[model samples]
Target: DAGVTQSPTHLIKTRGQQVTLRCSPKSGHDTVSWYQQALGQGPQFIFQYYEEEERQRGNFPDRFSGHQFPNYSSELNVNALLLGDSALYLCASSLALELRGYTFGSGTRLTVV
Candidate 1:
C-alpha cells in the first residue's frame, strides 16, 4: 500500500507570497494532519482533518489553513509567508478509529527568501 504523499518536495517563495502544499493520505486512512519542523526542532502540529473537517488546530496564526477532500486527500496553505515560515512541512495519515500510529510523508521543504 502507498503511504502519505506530498507534492513539490521543495519550494521557494518570497516573503509576501502564498504557498499551497498538497498531500494524499495513505490507503485505508481517514484522517490527515499537518506539521511544521524547523531546522532543529521537532515537528509541531499545525492542524488535523477528519471527515473533511478541521478537527483540531495548533498555535499557528490565522495565516495557516488546510483542507481535506472527500477522497481523504489534503492541502495546506500559508498566506503572507514570512522567512520564519520556512520549514519542512510534513503530512501524516492514520485511521481515526485506530490512532495507534501514523504514516508520514517525506515532507515539503519550504524556503522563503
Candidate 2:
C-alpha cells in the first residue's frame, strides 16, 4: 500500500505571501492530520480532517486552513504567511477513528523569506 506523500519537499516564500501544500494519505486511510515542526521542537498539531470535515484544530490563526477530499487526500493553505511560518509541514494519516500511532510523510519544508 502507498504511504503518505507530500509535495514540494521544500518551499521558499516571501513574508506575507500565501502558500498551499498538498498531501496524499496512505491507502485505505480516511483521516489526515497536519503538523508544524519548528527547528528543535516537536511537531505541533495544526488540524485534523476526517469524513471530509475538520474534526480538530489547534491554536493557529485564521490564516491556517485546510481541506480534505473524497479520496482521503488533503491540502493545507496558509494566507499572508509570516516569517515565523518557516517550518516543516508534516502530514500524517491513520485509519478512521483510530487513535493509534500515525505514519508521517517526509513533509514540505516551508522557508519564509
Candidate 3:
C-alpha cells in the first residue's frame, strides 16, 4: 500500500553535470512516468514506461531519458544539465495504461548553479 517515492528530496548541480532521480511506483502498478514541473506550472509529461519498455515520450531532448524496471520502479536521468534544467523533477505512477489517474511523489528539486 505504499505510494510512489522519490529520492534526495533536493539537489544542487552545476551546468554540464548529470543527475539521476529515482522513483518506486505504487503497488499493483505497471507503468511509470516522468514529468518536469517548473515553479508555479503544471507537470509536463516527459516520458512513460510500461512492460519494461518506454511506451511514450514527450518533447524533451535526448538529454531526458528514463527506465522502468521489472518491479515497476523507475529512474529519470538527465544529462549535460543546463541552468534551464533546474526545476522540480517529479515521478508519477499509474495502473497499467491509465495515464490520468496518476499518483505523484514529492519530487527531487534540482538547482543548477
Clashes of each: 0, 0, 0
The RMSD (Cα, Å) of candidate 1 is 0.7
Tell me the tens digit of each residue's lDDT in model 3 across 19-55. Answer: 9999998888788989999988998989999988999
Give the higher-lDDT candidate: 1 or 2. Answer: 1
Instruction: Rank candidates by TM-score, best first.
Output: 1, 2, 3
Q: Assess the local accuracy of residue 80 in candidate 1 as a C-alpha lDDT between 0 and 100.
A: 100
lDDT of 1 by residue, 33-55 (tens): 99999999999999999999999
Q: How high is the CA lDDT of each candidate model?
A: 0.96, 0.94, 0.90
Q: Against the correct fold, how does model 3 do in TM-score? A: 0.95
Provide the lDDT at 35 for model 2: 97
Model 1 alpha-carbon drift over 4 Å, by segment: none
- Of the pair 2 and 3, which is ahead by lDDT? 2
RMSD of each: 0.7, 0.8, 1.0
Error of 2 at 16 (Å): 0.7
1 versus 3: better lDDT goes to: 1
> For candidate 1, what is the lDDT?
0.96
Which pairs clash in the backbone of model 1? none
